[model samples]
Target: MAAKTDDSGPVLPPAIEYAWGLRDRPPKGPRPGMSVPAIVDAAVGVADADGLAAVSMSRVAKELGAATMALYRYVGSKDELLALMVDAGYGPSPGPPPPGTDWRAGLTRWAWAEHDVLRQRFWLLHVPITGPPITPQQLGWMEDGLRCLDGTALTEGEKMSTLLLLTGYVRNEATLASQIAEGSRATGAKPSEMMPAYGRLLAQLIDPARFPALQRVLAAGVLSQDDDPDDEFTFGLDRILDGVDALIGRRAAT
Candidate 1:
């Protein structure tokens, strides 16, 4: 697709416009079936199978059985390709919560929907956030999340901020889980073995007198084994919603 030239409004990346259907495919060069979504899907396939490093103009072109230069006719550059890939990778929003669901439950469902996507497509987490949500699917997610707060007393800005906070927590939790799993694989240790080993190592390295709080934790065997993976994620999600609930309460009160 060629870049949109009618720049009367806010300037946006071509891929963003392409995803939104604001840009049209050039009349001639690209192969008959080749289009923006087609190209983005092929690129996502490459990333999913071989990891993000395996994705490049040449590689994606090879997958599509086309010349590398030909890809430029559709995607202007690799950065543009990556952005489109992320939008496609996210697939779609889970849609708004069912009617009558409270805001906290809606946001919880929203947060988990995002969490599930990142966990499955961990590569999406590695993609740098060039800016805020602009692509269609990304904005769909933002819209659904904002819809959760539609009847709330909080201001529009507060609703957006609350979603931001929730998304950040979900991403951080997923990243930490992925990293820990990777670390366990690299060392060939079972996930269940990791915390116990860590606890033992810490016990030998610290002095009870100097690290009394930690010593008590060690004595209590808090790190004897890994907790259910969901336990940590659920705990953090509830705490964040608790704070949001309190704020919503304040807004309703005054």
Candidate 2:
């Protein structure tokens, strides 16, 4: 068969080239004993069972019944493997919204879909973001998010900024949920138990008369029980979308 060409030129990122089946297999080396899918699946399993800390190359190798160094034949480094693992976890872009859907609604659905993925694979929040995402799945999500604003009057820069803002909010919300779960696991105490102890510590450190605002927040029970996590996420997403809508309206008027 004739080698395929990406006639669009060097448009895709390097990692994406691998993802899109553009890279040819090495002709000289022994066939790789470990497949990329196997390695990624093993890594994900380890992470899901014991967290990301347990997903070392050696550990993954053991899971796959391969020699430790054999994994390197398929994946260049642990970092590269991690990138692939994240992309695998991301899966495919969701189906686009039906025609004439409002931009806000499209973006909201996109953000919530991403939030659901992160929530399910909570380790994703803890995976250190080393640099820009280069994986195909990640790029697919980026493309989908950008497409959400296609009918809007926003400039390319504005669209990009809005996507970044939404991504940051989703990541932050996921991190908060992960942290709360971790805290509960470590302390063996419910939020109610921990909240009172935290409040008492704060009371010892700050007099209510001196810090009225802080006092009021404490009294209002903001940090008491663990609030419904979904409610928290919805509240933040609504506020952000409201801000974006306000900006769009201003631009429309001017």
RMSD of each: 2.5, 4.8
lDDT tens digits, residues 28-88, model 2? Answer: 2244555777778899999989999888999998998878887777776787778888888
Kindly report which residue stretches of model 1 are placed more than 4 angstroms away from their true locations once superposed.
1-7, 13-15, 24-28
Candidate closest to the true structure, highest lDDT: 1
In order, candidate lDDTs are 0.86, 0.80
What tens digits encode model 1's per-residue C-alpha lDDT throughout 1-254? 12334558576565567678877743235487777777888999999997788899999989989999888887888888888888899989999989999898899899999999988888887887866667888889999999999999999999999999999999999899778878988999988888899999999999999999999999998987778878889999999999999999999999
Taking all chains together, each candidate's TM-score versus the true structure is 0.92, 0.84
- Candidate 1 lands at a TM-score of 0.92
